[model samples]
Target: MLLAIILVTLIVLIMLRVPVAFSILGTGFLGLVLLGGLGHALPILETAPATAVRNSSLSAISLFMLMAQFMLMSGLLDSLFDAARSLVGRIPGGTGVASVGAGTAFAAVSGSSTAAAATLAQTSTKRMLSEGYQQTVASGLVASVGTLAAMIPPSIILVFYAITAEASVGDVLVAGFFPGLLIAIAMVATMYVGMAFQKGAVPAGQRSTWAEKWKSLWHASPLLFIFVAVVGSIFLGIATPTEAAALGALVALILVVARGRFTTQKFLVAVAETVKSTAMILAIVMAAHVLGHFLTETRTAPKLVQAIEDSAMPALLVMVLIAAFYVLLGFFMDQVAIIALTVPIVLPVVEELGYDAVWFGIFMILLAEVGMITPPMGLNVFVVSKSSGIPAVVVFRGAFPYVVVMLLMAMVFLLWPGLVMWVPNLMG
Candidate 1:
């Protein structure tokens, strides 16, 4: 009854358009009161919020967000995209593929999918649309491909998952490297195939000159160095994950200022945006803590775990079901909120099934990436549409093929866990 009430109340509040954080916290608090009375619930309410704020792992969130914000405002994002375009612009549907490539590169720096989608949408979508690309193709590619940002290394999602699941943040981040690259490769291949069949869909354009390409490459070198420095130091044991983030942010800021792209106005704006995004993420996380606490106190997670164990479902099938649930929920909820609310319930089952926590973390991120492009509530779709002034349907249609690619990538990871485990194993 308590679990059902919490679930129902959360759903109702979400349907009523309550902010996700509030809905989670309110339902959890209400459920706690019902289960243990005001005496117990009040203390939980007071204590959980403080505990949530004091969490050290959460410091990574602000640092990473600040890094992304500074980079975006610094104009480095555009330089990276231009370099990607120069490299891939000659192939069929190359612009779209370039967007995915650029997005993946940006993901290394930004760490958030929404920021990637928003930044790329602002940079690439307009150009693609104005160049006469089909609205569906342009919008969909951006929306779906932007998800690569979250799968790539330096992902905020991976960091959060690592912290919450008590896994190594560096290991989880390293584990994502290959799978994220695979997704990008698959998405690019899908674009090539789609363009092959529908030749007129993506017109071939003039290939960039060697000189021009080299110029763009030179301009993007700083971003590459930042990536190598941060991810490399962690992999080499020279710096911890938190230290890498701090170093990355500092390097990014230096690059921005050296390029003369960091104005006082832009700096302030980046700070403001970082604060807003970070606060929103933290709020949902705190609420999730409350929900997770309630679920644990009520033994709801244990009951579910026992039921799953009793069922004769194969471990692989269980993973598929969980992935499907994420896809469905992704349509309605933000990825961070979903992770926070479900990780406590799901991670224990994953452990019992004998999967590596770091590997499972990558799997979860891949699934969430798919969710970002999947439906009526796909945030990236809305972002792409808004940026391109294209209809959401067009974007959804364009993203369909990429979604298949993501699903296929998920299946590959499921079948050959080595794709995710290899890097981390090497590091260990």
Candidate 2:
């Protein structure tokens, strides 16, 4: 009965358009008071705000965000996009392929899927259209690739998941690489196949000279270096996640200064934006802690676990049902909010089923990413529409194939968890 009230009140608040952090915070605070009186709620309310933000692991988010901002200020994304185009642009629907490459590269730095979608929509969509690619194909590819921002390393979502799951941040971040790479492969192949079978999907263009490819690759090498240094350092035990982030940010800062792109305005903007983004994430973390406390005290997740056990359902079937529920939530909520709300409840059940928390972290993130391009909210789709003036419906059609690809990949990941854990295992 108490769990029902907690769930219902949270739903009502979310439906009323309350901010997620506020909604979760209010629901938990009120639940605590109701469940154990003001005596219990007051101390948590006072302490959670401080403890949540004080997490040492969270510093990595600020640094990685700052690194992305600095890289943006220096215009590195354009270099990476141009380089990808030079290498891949001759293939059928090649510009669309390059957009995915650019999107994933950008994702390596900027963890926000919406930011990746908007940037690529502005930068790549026009080129894909000018290159005689189908509008649906061009727009859909950009929107779809944005979700990669959540899957790639240095992803903010990974950090959030680490905090919530009480898992190793480095392990979870490392685990994303293979799955992210596989998804990228599938997305790119979908483009190649879609263009090849369908006449007039993409008009053939001149192949790039070897010289042009080399030049573009050379110009983009530093961006590649940053990605390697950050992830490699963490993988090789040379730096902790926070230290890797600092190193990445420092390199980005130095690069901008050397390139004469550093400006007081851009620097200030980066810092200010980092502060804002960090604060917002911290709020969600704090609220989630409060909510987690309420759930734990009420023994809600344990009860749910026991109920499932009592029903004697197969673990596989139970996991599939949980996956479906998460996807349904994805339609309405972004990954961060969903993680904050659900991880506390779902994680114990997941562990009880003999799954690794690090693997589940990647799994949860990959599922949330699909939501970015799916309908209703489909935040990435709207971002592309707003930036590129592509009709949402057209983008939706474009994204549909990738949606199929993601669903298939989710099943693949579920059946073979080692695909995610292999690198993390080596890193250990």
Name the lDDT value of residue 30 in candidate 1: 89
Q: Compute each candidate's TM-score over C-alphas.
A: 0.96, 0.97
lDDT of each: 0.84, 0.87
* TM-score of candidate 2 relative to the true fold: 0.97
Off by over 4 Å in 2: none
Query: For candidate 1, which ten residues in a row score worst on lDDT?
Result: 197-206
lDDT of 1 by residue, 1-428 (tens): 76887798899998889999999999998888888899988888888977887877777778888888878767888887789889988876678877888888988788878778888888878778777787777778788778877777788888888877879889998888888888888887887788778868887764899999999999888898679767888889998888888888899899888988878898888889889988998898788888877898988778888999999789999989988987777777777888888888888888887788999898887887776887767888888888777888778888999888888888899889998999999997
Question: How far is 282's C-alpha from truth in model 1 (Å)?
Answer: 1.9
lDDT of 2 by residue, 1-428 (tens): 88789889998998788988999999999999999999999999999778777889889988888887888887877887788889988876667778888988988876778888888998899888887888988899989988888888988889889977889989988888889889999999888778768889977754789999999898888787678778889999899999999998998888899889989988999999999988888888889889888988988889888988899988889888888888888988878899988988998898888889999998877877788888888999999999999889999999999988988898899999999899998976
Candidate 1, residue 92: how far the Cα is off, in Å = 3.1
